[model samples]
Target: MPRSPWWGRKVARLPERGTLIVSTDLQGNYEDYYALKQIYADEEERGNEPVLLLCGDLVHGPGEYFADPARWPDYLGTFYRDRSVDLVLDYAEWIDHAKTVALLGNHEHAHIGGPIVSKFHGDEAAVLDIRLGDDAPRVHDLFRSFPLIAVAPCGAVFTHGAPRATEPDLASFERIRYDGYARTAINDMYEEGTLGALLWARYAEPEHAQALLEAVHEGEGRHAFVAFGHDVVRSGYEKIGKEQICVSTSFGCEDRNKTYLRLDLGARYTSVDDLREGEEIRKLYPKA
Candidate 1:
């Protein structure tokens, strides 16, 4: 775990020891949120000091307002009401904020001035704030403090989106200002400008990830993968090229197939294949 400022840290360096639990794109899904917590809690109860990394998009989920999502068939929008407001309040008061590391998703950036993320209700970030009422200010402060990406010693970099950057260096990340960027609706692409690309890229080719890895650890994990969430990976996880893996823990994915990373910090993974399914990649509720 690392300390954070009132604004942003831009990047996080994960602990060199202990179990690392990585989840992504929760997006106000109450079911998966609780499942994640339970997974962490179980690890703690087992005397494992598990570090949880939530890779952004924690808010602005489509409630009944957006109608039944076509891709996410298991979404129980009517019954449980997995509203972003509740997620905010629960997250704010959750006993584990100290152990939880969050990434600044583009949706979250909308409130604090990064990009306009509109999904269910136009300007969903603003709508979340208005709905938050008194808690909005406090929650917004917490969101502002979240990092854009986390670098781990296990030969992997965790981020909300593809590992896109202005310069091919880590020091450059500290200079980001988080200004809003334009979305090219013609191609349905959200291009992150000079400030930050931490929450934009929807896809990452092997070469693209190779360039990113070359900048970190002096190419130590050049053959490794960058773990991220942004697109809706059908199996809830997919290997992209040779150096990128997308894991969709929640939001617009199958319940049984949705996955998260339970990585061993002490063990260095050489490639995405080292991340074995049901071993390193665990489903929310796997059936026997």
Candidate 2:
């Protein structure tokens, strides 16, 4: 099936005035999902509407903890798929408020044979059977529509992984233009180890970060910053270069290890702070 025309746009512009964007990697953790809801609610209560951008990994793939024999069957059934859908529904308010933009993560790509295919082989079929089943087109559509990379109006880039470029330069990045075919382009970058394959990347060196910022600025014509979440950094957000920031929202199932990035977006300046050891929504919704 052809993808929606919306995904064809390479970069999306945020509100010109300013918008707070909450970027996080929710690896199918109910606690993190609920915490995100509270974050959005809290921001709304403060009279400041914010954009909630999910940096992918919304569903824990079979390559994750599902490898255990006890969890494989359930994961293949509806556990992961249902949770993925629930995450979207929980943030549906942003769909209208600030317009939530969910990027495609490596785990999300695993369902459609991205880099993780080598590890899960046949298990991918189980995911397809449930997510793309006759009655679940909506779930499949949601994943299909997710963009590989999202560029904010302020020139900030939000992606699930770091860009995959061999050379840390703006020229190399400019060559990687997103003219539709995003899935294929991302997969090719993953295969070639280029900076454009943000979903499959793990780390960005200082040079890579500099190159990415320049590329975004030159290609999009604005001062740009790149923020991504993939590799978990227990210490909180890390600055690879002056223009790049990495955050690990998942603390590996430990309550003490949780942290996320609070971004203050402005027409002139963009700032980010590490929010660590904060309140968990589980305290309020015991059943959730």
Q: What C-alpha lDDT does candidate 1 achieve relative to the native structure?
A: 0.74
With a 3 Å backbone cut-off (N, CA, C), the pairs that clash in candidate 2 are 14-153, 163-195, 164-194, 164-195, 164-196, 165-194, 165-195
Give a tens-digit lDDT track for model 2, residues 1-288: 321133323344445443454455665565567776676677767866566667877765345466455665521322332254455444443454444567776666555445333334444435544644563455545565666666556656676787544334433433443323334544465655452357677776756655655555555432456778877665546666455677666533234444555445555433232222232111222232
Worst 10 residues of 1 by lDDT: 71-80
Instruction: Report how far residue 79 has shifted in candidate 2, in Å.
Output: 15
What TM-score would candidate 2 get against the native?
0.67
The per-model lDDT (C-alpha) reads 0.74, 0.53
lDDT of 1 by residue, 39-150 (tens): 9889979978788889988887765644444543454322234567777678766634447778888788777766566677767777788889988888878787887778
Model 1 alpha-carbon drift over 4 Å, by segment = 1-7, 66-80, 95-98, 180-190, 194-196
TM-scores of all candidate predictions against the true structure: 0.87, 0.67
Q: What's the residue-level lDDT of 91 in candidate 2?
A: 48
